[model samples]
Target: MIGFTLLIALVGAERIAELTVARRNRSWALSRGGVEYGRGHYPGIAAAHAGLLGGALLEAWLLDRPFIPALGWPMLGLAVLAQGLRWWCIATLGRRWNTRVIIVPDLPLVARGPYRRLRHPNYVAVVAEGIALPLVHTCWITALLFTIVNLGLLRTRIRIENTALRQAADTTPASP
Candidate 1:
């Protein structure tokens, strides 16, 4: 139980750090005339993420889930890998990365780092973490529920992002 609590605390701290970085990046993007897409869904996304954290803790504590070493260890490893991938995405995008879908017009799409292989590598990390974090303590219900909801949310998010990217590409002036 104590270990689970510590895990939650660490995850919470990481979330705070991510939000700080997002805010900084947001400011940078906005200063450079970045236009945001999918503002209508931003609150839903935020609420769902908050719910994920809270639900994991509740399911683990209230249901008294056991941290099966076999499952927990592997899930922990996946969670760590997800975090690493997420940070790699952040580093790759640098000032362009944010929690929201803010795009600076006419900028070429980033194709470095993880983006070279996967267009949505950050979302991949998010999906992996969504599953791994809850399963670390055998909270299968939370893991499954979050994954389902997140997929639905990601559908809309990806659509908006793709549209924005297309618009940006269309508007970019061709160099001779």
Candidate 2:
């Protein structure tokens, strides 16, 4: 339980850092005429994430869940890996990365780092953390609930992002 609490605290701190980076990036992008899409779903997405964290803690405590050594160890490792991937995405995207779906017009798509291999590597990290974090403390219910809700949210998010990306690509002039 102590370990789980510490883990959650660390995750919370990591989220704060990500938000700091995201806010800076968002400001930089908006200053350069970046347009945001899918604002309608943003609130729900935010709620789901907040719920995941709170629900995990609540469920673990209320259910009196004990950390299963086998599952907990592997989930902890997976959570660490997810954080690494999340940072990699942020580093690769630089000022283009944000919590919201904001795209700067005429900028070519980033194709380096994890982006070279996967179109939505950041979401992969989100999914991984969503699952791994709760499971680390034997909070399977929280893990399953967040995964389902997040998937629904991602469906709309991806569609909006793809359309935005395509529109940006169309508007960008072909290089000589």
lDDT of 2 by residue, 50-132 (tens): 89889999999999988999999999999999999999999999989999999898899999999999999999999999999
What TM-score, to 2 decimals, does candidate 2 have?
Answer: 0.98
Report every candidate's CA lDDT.
Answer: 0.92, 0.94
What does the lDDT come to for candidate 1? 0.92
Candidate 2: residue 75 Cα off by (Å) = 0.5
Best of the candidates, lDDT: 2
After aligning candidate 2 to the native by TM-score, how far in Å is the CA of 106 from where it should be? 1.4
Give the range of the ten consecutive residues with the poorest summed lDDT in model 1: 1-10
Task: Provide the global lDDT of candidate 2 against the true structure.
Answer: 0.94
**Residue 83 alpha-carbon offset, candidate 2, angstroms:** 0.5
Candidate 1 clashes: the total is: 0
